[model samples]
Target chain A: MSRVGVVAIRRGIRVSIYLPIAELSVNMIILLAMGGAVGFLSGMFGVGGGFLITPLLIFYNIPPAVAVATGANQVIASSFSGALAHFKRGTVDIKLGMVLLAGGVAGSSVGVYVFALLRALGQLDLIVSLLYVVFLGTIGALMMWESIGALRKAGKGGSTTLKKPGQHNWVHRLPLKVRFRASKLFVSVIPVLGLGAFIGFLASIMGVGGGFIMVPAMIYLLKVPTNVVIGTSLFQIVFVAAFTTIVHASTNQTVDVVLAFLLMLGGVAGAQYGAKVGQRLRGEQLRALLAGLVLIVAIRLAVDLFVRPADVYSLAPGVL
Target chain B: MKRCARKHALAVIGMLLAVAVGGPSAFAQDQGEPPRETINIGLSTEVVAITPDFSGADLTIFGSLENPDPQILRQGRYDIIVVLEGPLRPVVVRRKDRIFGLWINVDSETFSSVPVSYSVAMTRAPQDITDAKSYKQLSLGIDNIHLRPAGENADPSKTEEFGLALRSLKQRSGLYNERVGSLTFIGSNLFRASLALPANVPVGTHRARAFLFRNGSFIDEASDQLMIVKSGTEASIYRAANTYGFFYGVFAVILAVITGWIGRIVFKRD
Candidate 1:
């Protein structure tokens, strides 16, 4: 009876075990126990469930795509609950999160719509495949360059330039100004609208969280100090993803509780230690490694476009 | 006594069962209710059998969509049945990268209909099939194929069949007796092949199996096997699809901020 329970839960399958002495399966029991450990890690750090968890899901025989969706569902809930806890501690940058959220929501809605469009045209994979190559390739290249620069100036560290928009750019000249006291700046709200929408759209289309895009944009584009970017970004993602989850659920019905919980279970815990470990390692090395990985993936995706490996071609209309 | 080890193992198993299975319910109170929904063409309602149609050759087998799912799969899970025509065609595989990403497919770029796996094979023997291209246009044509609606009539002894199409390096596939042995071959040498709809494809077969043809005869045949284990496979794929951009993005950004924060901590010496 006990073994049965372990197998069921570890697989994230909601199976009832009322047998007095239910026989346990070795695989299932360890898997569920692992979920708990991962969840703990998520609490320590500040991340959604999918990034680290889904891959693990595959380890237990879950399909990659299913693993990914399930992880998303779990991350949505964990983020909501965790964000609330963080809110109580006043660690979250609500104001900043809100701006990003506003844009993220807009972008995500449009992103979903765009996805629908691609689906309709039956060329969604084509677009997604294209965007992934372009986006990952560009970001990977930029990350590699920065990491190299950082490594060259390792001991002679100065400071990253907090670049703002050009004087003639419309963003700086916009009328309404938004201020983040912690970040210590007064920037135009217009940029947030445009930026959030862009990231949000990308997030939706690519099934990505938009943090990779957001963090960099905040630091370089708006010149938001690096100190507050992560926390603020998390705060924003909590809402944006939650909204996306709801939208996907109601509109697309793409949320999987079991998958999410399993991944979240691991990610939350992994994040805590990962944060600790991440702190110890060379940021440059991690960045370089990450860049290399993304570039490799990008090259593969780009070649796929010309080769046209995608099998389906029936087209349809999409919605936002 | 050997009984001692068995007892010890049982005890450990009991302890694990409580922890592993009970773990979910432990937080069941904490979790939200499961959301229920469906996609356009969802469910793998048949066991697609890929026979040795292309028997000894590195022939690329093609499939047609049976049940269409309007909503795309978030957790993409579909098994392939590599049914070949009687005898396979001349095969050359290549891996190349275009604007998209790395595609495992045939060497040709423009006329590349489907991305195919790059594996070399001979009629009498399946050689070390490596360094080949992935299938470019060898998959089914439909995305999000819809299954039976939620409230459709249930027939106890009814099966359904969807249309089938076969494409290869040639336009028309036919039986070639001279080359290696009695086998099927695509007629046209132009590059790609499309759909071959069969008139006698059984009606209402739930999910049926039919041969994939090129010109006028049977070459390769396949079908989909329904595996509705629990009815949540659709949601499984949908949920995890849109997570990467947000979550990892956050991790990357936060780490950068932490770096700056630590920089401040260390730079205090200056």
Candidate 2:
């Protein structure tokens, strides 16, 4: 059961939970509900909940700056748990994850600087929202289309062959080749590093763990085994999120620990329950559901961009 | 929790009672002195401590309209406007313009000094109480608040519209409020108003100003101060997060890791 009894009401229609960095009180129930919903989806789909949580936080009237930074803080917890589970299963490629982590940390630093510049220019909200619409829209559509194709293939009783990774791909032709025994792939470290850096850049600016993006990129592009992709992505995400948290905390002062803690209270439990529920669903069905959810969020964001806002002007503290 | 909240309420009431009983006699003691314009005010609490359990507070402002001429009192032409204004801070107001079929922030205005929260209670509607010139001079209403832009680039004439937009936004957020005839009279000379400080009220020293008007003319104004501060664990955490950000971030990471580990143990699956 949810800890509904813990909620303390301030006034009519308000159950306030003070966010330290945001320096405001938000509805406790709403924050927890959002966290739980995203956490459940993360556990069921093996995607970091940040992609959903950050957008939902924005919808709840949290400042985009605060939402992105604090979302990174919260992702640390979820990714840590997910990573540990994969570690215990012996699916995590620790060396590859470390290399990705190194690249991710460097990339996040540059991303944080870029985020600061956009914020200074008062374009952070526009950029973040636009990024969400483009990336989420493209990724969701692709996932849905691919999963539908797989489902159709299964329906026709045809055997599907995954083209052997690293065989004739441009990724293998690059210099500085390294062998990863766990995924049984021999690939250039340059592409892996470049991929990690790109995902890290997106993760920092978009307030997502970049797991959904990273998982697909690793499997199809880097040719990492399906079993190892989730674990390695989680491993890299943990460090990237932690690094992003510190950078944001030190620079932007937007990491609201109080809010993050409250979110985790619901997220941790919801993830466990969701994992249990996930055991009953097939892989294609899970992918379909996740893709549908992503598309829905993307469309919602797109509609917001097109629709006229009731108030054309907004106020944030401090001079531009 | 119920008992704790009641205790706080009782404490506030006791303070108000002390002020009510002790205030008049002190001022009346100087009987031979010439009468002068004076306003005496007392708050239910001078300081609001926002601990982790603090949701918000309903603050009471009680005061007396002292030394008004007996003739004016008899004429019953006095109006009172009580305003509580939060600390001034810079604010950015952005306007979205349609660009290529999508709304984007094309124009922006920055106000160097604007109250984070402002609430006003008047004895009657502002328009009925005074003329527009006096209202602007006194900043009596939400629309009349003078929030000037930081830089001179913004056109002066467009500021009114921008100010109105800011007011609407703040009003929707429950940070700005205006109430007509909300103040009640305890007697002919004493009046009190209660303001509900929303949970999101900006933490700072707030000014509670009361203005007196008679026959559509400004009479006298008195102002008092109230401080809202974070206390207990909330304060400590907030302090750490701001003062020692990098360490706090690391601590946050450790906390998350520990919680995640414990969650894994508790929810262990074969």
Candidate 3:
């Protein structure tokens, strides 16, 4: 009997579902729970959950290629759902989003090309794990430090309002200035487009919606108004992630639709309850908790990279 | 003297039975010098459909031997080996090396044609049935399957290493398997062989071959083809993904959009 069959027989339940592209059987309940848990975290922190979901799937033993591609596909659902709410609230800056998308499209195309090259070279898995470790480690540490500082300040009876530093920065001095009326800011289109392109490249390579990086880049570097930051980021992410999904599907044929659909089903439903719970928690505490979680995942991936694998030899289809 | 008489009586009874069932051919063969032995195998189904919940299954192949010498058959010198080989496909085997404190795939070797799966069932242990040279010549066992390296001028040592790795990996994955003593003779000339088909059996045209041997010397062989195919919606989805990838991708996006839209409508919180 196959391993899945043995497991099914042992458990006395019929919860395993076959993934077409991945060509494997996985427990449905486990996938659903994973999606729901990541969705809960995303809703709680107001961040796109792609960063979390991709690694989680990898930890669950899904092939890196399938996980990365399917993660991008799953991101579309949550981003679209979030963007709709922002659109209704009139917080999305259409002009700004459009400019960002132009750069995002170009960057995503190049990223897909590189992705295919690495896969053929058999370096894709290593590169994906390394990138995840670096990004998650840095972001998690920074979030942890910042949240801890905030918590300490609150404990000392001080106002915890986040300080907005000098409005003019090196980013503001770049050429090709443009005005975004909704954001109420005049900024160089060069920095805006560059940032978007950078995030788009990461989105394709890392299988993330790029919100974790994009949100901070917008707030600190571009100095976009806080209200419009998330809305505009989601608007751009919805398009970039969508493009990444299509390109990956066409180029790599790695996207598992069954896997993506399962994740979306659990994610959308879990987000509602997560949002409710999020409202009750303090922002600093939530940030600190999320940071810890991110660091743990990063550490786990890093350990795998350092530790010896069970088998040094592996097989793949097709001739080199 | 009594034992010899009983043996003669049994052989006569066997000869009469063969003549009665094996027809005029048996009579002609009996009149002539001992006839050459032949083997014939039959599969109940030509196409094996794999459903969504398909697990591994045992495939039984029935065969019969013609004009077998009763004395050799009673002595158990006759042995049969049956093999079910999946379609051949190109494969690459990669070896990982530690570089900069990380395990990374540094070298790979490719084979032009390798069976996706190989399942063997033999009357006895491989070593007991035939010599290593004979097995290699016939390519009868898992280790003996010829794995041709893809490119020319490949290092012989490396090719051998990769070939070994390929066989070991396939065996570990249950795709290449062996079942000794699974081929059993029910009558003097009738036998049955059972081969295990893995759950992840590649969907393709597989060849089931039965080899007949007398006293460890090759006599005859027969083969039949069986098609293993994915049935129902799963097969359609697999075909769509490979054939119309772009449209499939668009459909995936549309499905996601609909699911998200439904989620928002069903659980409206904002």
Candidate 4:
């Protein structure tokens, strides 16, 4: 019997595995390696790796829907493990995290609804790519700018201390103030909830844990202590990502457990080593490197949008 | 229609049997009014179970032509076409147009009840066996398969464009395919056809249809059902995902949590 179809048989041994929900066979080692690479980056940056994983999966030709949903699923594992470490260190602000979780849940619900709407409208891929380009470009550019300034200061033998948190911003003047004992600050619930909701929305749509956005927002916007920021952001991300995964699975039925599992296994293992390596690097240098990586991804996605596709037409499973 | 075809096939088989037992004189006497030719196909297995590592396989369909004309068979005037058509489902075809330096989906058309996959094997080139008119009438070839736009009043030109796009996309993906000269005569009466089942073949009930053409004219046609399904664990996973999505979602989350916990324990350094 002659074998035929998309997967061409190579001369050497190849370990291919089938993803049930994705409905395709992919090289197992390639998936694991992708997970490990993203996991390493996330560990070094003290962020969830969902932002990297979703786009990588898309590049590998996994359907955007499956890639997004499964990315959310994979984020839960890394964030949960990271959160556990933070919990042990007693750095996570549980009260602040809970409030953020509340807003995240609500925002995720709306995001999932919109995701389905966009998918049905046959604009999901475009919207997803567009969003990635916008967010990644903005964040990467900002990080690069900030870190370069810090690097220049250090080069001149000046202390690269972070800005004093007590300096009040307009966000501090907002109403509905809430006190979080762990972070030792008084902050408005309005911005906290809104920020959580915004990240949650992006998490559901982009299949990210939102840590890349959440950590910075906590430190710069909410004025949360830097010591507690990573832990608290991760705490909320764990639950938010969990919530997004369940909803996407139940509503869209797009989550592939097999794919998620492979990613998670490789991720958690790689993260530990990444964290060790991260500790040896200076904060400014790490930020600069991460910014460069993010910008490259953004530029690649932008190129795809601008370049003519191989085919002008595409097919979807359902009627529009 | 299937029952009628089956009856015709039985009659052809009965006549062939009578001629076999009644000797040369019996066949000579029956030649004055030649019996109608009929086609029948049998699959080696009723269902094809795809394992996890399944790449692709050739599905051999054994068939026979009853009451075939001796002269037509000898002269290679008889031709057979076998098609394995996947289950029907609605499909949307979208066209991307350049908008502000970005290619975005600007137009789309929906086609209902479109076959998910169509694989055809023939005794000869489709054009060599029959005229285009006959092929279109019978809907025997890929181009001949009718695609109906979901909207009743869709633009004819747009609908045709989308329909062509859909066919080419399916062909590019190996879901819709054709293999010329894949059917061969085993002897004088029996023929075998090999249809390539692509690795990405959709799991559902597929129809195996055989069309007979003698001297470039349409003759009898017959079809049988074949089930293509994922086997064991893969089958259960697919079913569970579609059927009990809520529980599956919960399970997925729990599995992730456990994996995370275990990873920390095994590789714990802190």
Candidate 5:
């Protein structure tokens, strides 16, 4: 009953028991265990752990940045676990993942540079928040919008209807000929790279691994099958995030290994269970729910932007 | 794993999805007890300045902080600061939002029950003295921290939105890191100035002050100006925007549509 939507609480105000996690207290253990639990969710659903963990951190009165950063650290481990499992299964498309990761790295570099530029300009936070709000909201609405349409169609006894293949356009005609044996398709690597770079830009800018976007891109742009797409994207995300974590850690020690380990422990187990449970839902139902969850997060972020923060210093934990 | 997941994903998703959309449970902690401690904010600095030739000269700022408080601090209200060093004037800059809908790359918020936070509020807002309006003014700055994608801007899209009311500056409000630093407009041909130290600036130097406050007290400001920064060098900042989420979501849905289409059209594979 404790606020079903953890991220829904307004930030900017102090609200909680004010229990600080000591250097190494039960709080730390809880944080680590919770992080792992969130990590499991990320693996099972292949979504960013922040979607779950950051809010949990906030619930404990942890600053949003720390929550987000810690969750990101945890993501490294969870993604690695998922990738390893997928690789063992031979479902991962290593070559494709590499191309996407290349784009992601390049994009992240640019995104980080831009982030610095904006900070120098003094508008980094607002832009990021606003963009997050708008982007997430629209995506959520689009997904929900489409899913509702599906539900309506289904209600009318026409749920399984399919539309014709739209125009292929230039995406298919580019020079490089690449093949995906699992999906039985041979296409240009250009689209893959372009998509990867584009998504990578977002990943770098946002500091997320870009799995939320990567999974879908593999399925649509590169035309991989649904089941394998998640596996393949995980393969790419694992390396990308792990490398990013290491780089960030080596550079700033931002990649909290302890945090990552905690998150991963929970994530691996949660994923196994989530996968088990996910098998029962219809595809649309799952999509609708996931989309809804995503939308809720996006809206909260957007609201945080324009609305007066419930309390200021939303990002300040130690500083505040 | 795949076999196991495929077999169970449906059930798991079904249960979660049902609960997710079913509406919030009424008594689920509408709001919780407030944090029980006073957080002492120690920072290096809160603001920075833009390099010359940047439409004139712009600035960015951030406040690094720490909790001197001994007890566990929840994330909440604490004042941050930004007193312009000089160039004193109002500035306008775009503060872009990701739009208020479900987006692709940007992260969607999630709920959790973790216990690691120090809730507090920053008491200082960035401001500049305005001789024209006869009062102090301040506004959000460029980028959440003076950083952005290439070819994009940190300025506001509207003129009126960029202008700050003295009363608003006088009255403190809530803020999030996402929208911090993005200024609306910083005058044409940029001017230079120093910012006044807001009363409660945490006991640390700022990274870039002029970069954050702009020309004097003409613009509304967030207190990131007084952050710890290397002197005279352009400070680099970044956001956690998650662009991949956008593309991934976009492409994933598109693929779902396409596959469903092709499943029916090509081989009736659906």
Candidate 6:
């Protein structure tokens, strides 16, 4: 029998394919569906969808190591697709992305080393879970509050104040300034690089693309244009996630190529449809919806941590 | 599911019948006035092929007791325990403790030569069939499996606790299984046991050992080797990832980039 042929047992139940790296058999249909859903949300919200996909994979009982590594692999496809769209529209700030990527590369190396230490101590899962709770909770709540205010102002016929491109903030006061033409801003490179590196580190640890954190940071802290922020962050994310994948592959050997392929197959197609659907929604409503989703995911993670677990003792393969 | 199970049952029966017909003369050689205890065992599948669609599999072990007196058999003079053990590897078991309102892994133990998967089916419980000492010596039950600490001078009691925790975790994941009264007697002197291999069963040369106990005493044993291997695309991918991991990672990234670029071009409207 051909290896790839559908395995139908006597009971008419189609057997699932095994993922070598994950060491589990998963239904292809389920993975495809998950990838499609996450990709659609990613395209619509201008987020990498890593925040959602990582937790979801864990929920399905995938090993956290495999999930995190493969999650980075899946993010690359969607981020690349989104970045391309932004590039065509001339919204991507290549200089800003390059600056961010430089820091991200260094940060990811450190993150991978730290991840190995945590895994040795058997604390990687706890740390990853806590990270999701803290970052997702804070970011989600803040975004919800901001979007709600925006919606209220729009409802009351009050125009929201937009920050001027050349407005001098404490960030601009720092030395090592650089001009990003697409963003229409002259900002100190220190904070920008530092922000990118910090997010990259978290992304490596948490198995996320870090676009959720990068988007808001650029908008509020760096004062970059909203149109350019998404594209630039995505551009940086492609490199960060790609670098993370290679690091994980060579170091941990945790990347499941089959699982990543199944997810990316659905993700690429779903992203296209999601972008089309996104055009119908207003900016404030989309932000509000995205905030709600982020909050929901955060709450679920909190529940996992706080609630009593069914099994308190866990067994993991020996760390090298 | 029922049909599949039935099919598997029929296949196992057919194989056993073939073996029984071919081996009767060997059994007759041992026949005597005082029927001696003997076991003839064969596995339905000598080699398990793990194709890409290998979710899991069921292997049937069938055997016959040669020259068993009817009265002795009626009095339950024989007990059989069949154990299927996968390849061994090192494993770490962690225990979570509530510390300052949060559950954290505070203690961990590492052990070498731990079976990745194990399943035992017996005619009766180990306690009922044999003494505790023999059970431990033979590794007849999950608790009795030997898991030595990996190069550490650890406390025996602490290691025992960790071993229990490891066994519990593996059992929950369906990696370690123990089933009593699962070895069914098809007819007089003919017995069969079915082992269900989980999807996560490690790939290696595994051994299935069947032990026959008579009146709470170890009598005879039979062992057979079963090779579990990854075949086709699964094998290729696994081989490449391990041998050429760097190139594999690069290929993965490039594949994603190309797919993403193509997705935009094909789907873009206006």
Q: In order, what are the TM-scores of chain A for the candidates?
A: 0.70, 0.93, 0.97, 0.96, 0.76, 0.92
User: For residues B116-167, could you state the per-residue lDDT of candidate 6 as single tens digits?
Assistant: 9998999987789999999888877888899998855988988989999898
Q: Give Cα-based local distance difference scores for all models.
A: 0.42, 0.80, 0.88, 0.88, 0.43, 0.82
| Candidate 3 residue runs with Cα over 4 Å from true position | A1-11, B1-17, B20-23, B28-30
Query: Top model by TM-score, which number?
Result: 3
Give each prediction's DockQ, rounded to 2 decimals: 0.03, 0.40, 0.69, 0.70, 0.02, 0.44
Stretches > 4 Å off in candidate 2: A1-16, A22-30, A160-163, A179-185, B1-34, B50-58, B232-236
Best by DockQ: 4
**Tens digit of per-residue lDDT, candidate 2, span A8-98:** 3335566776677776567788788888888888888877799999899888778889899888888988899999999989999988998
Q: Give stretches of model 5 more than 4 Å off.
A: A1-69, A119-122, A159-167, A250-253, A310-320, B1-270
lDDT of 1 by residue, A195-312 (tens): 8788767656555555567778877677776766766776776566656655554444334443343334344444445446556667677677667766776776566456654442
Top-scoring candidate (lDDT):
4
Taken in order, the candidates have interface RMSDs of 16.0, 2.4, 1.1, 1.2, 17.9, 2.1
Q: Estimate each model's TM-score.
A: 0.47, 0.86, 0.95, 0.94, 0.48, 0.86
User: Candidate 2, DockQ to 2 decimals?
Assistant: 0.40
Better of 1 and 5 by DockQ: 1
Models ranked on DockQ: 4, 3, 6, 2, 1, 5
Q: Write the per-residue lDDT of candidate 2 for residues B132-245, one digit (tens) a residue.
A: 999888877788888888886878867766777888988877679887888766765788977767556778999999988877788788999999887876678788888998
Query: What total of clashing residue pairs does each candidate reach?
Result: 129, 0, 0, 0, 218, 1
Q: Write the per-residue lDDT of candidate 5 for residues A11-73, one digit (tens) a residue.
A: 322121111111111234565467556544554455755445544654454433334344445
| Residue B143 in candidate 5, Cα distance off native in Å | 32
Arranged by TM-score, best first:
3, 4, 2, 6, 5, 1
TM-score of predicted structure 1: 0.47
TM-score of chain A for candidate 2?
0.93
Deviation of model 4 at A174, angstroms = 2.1
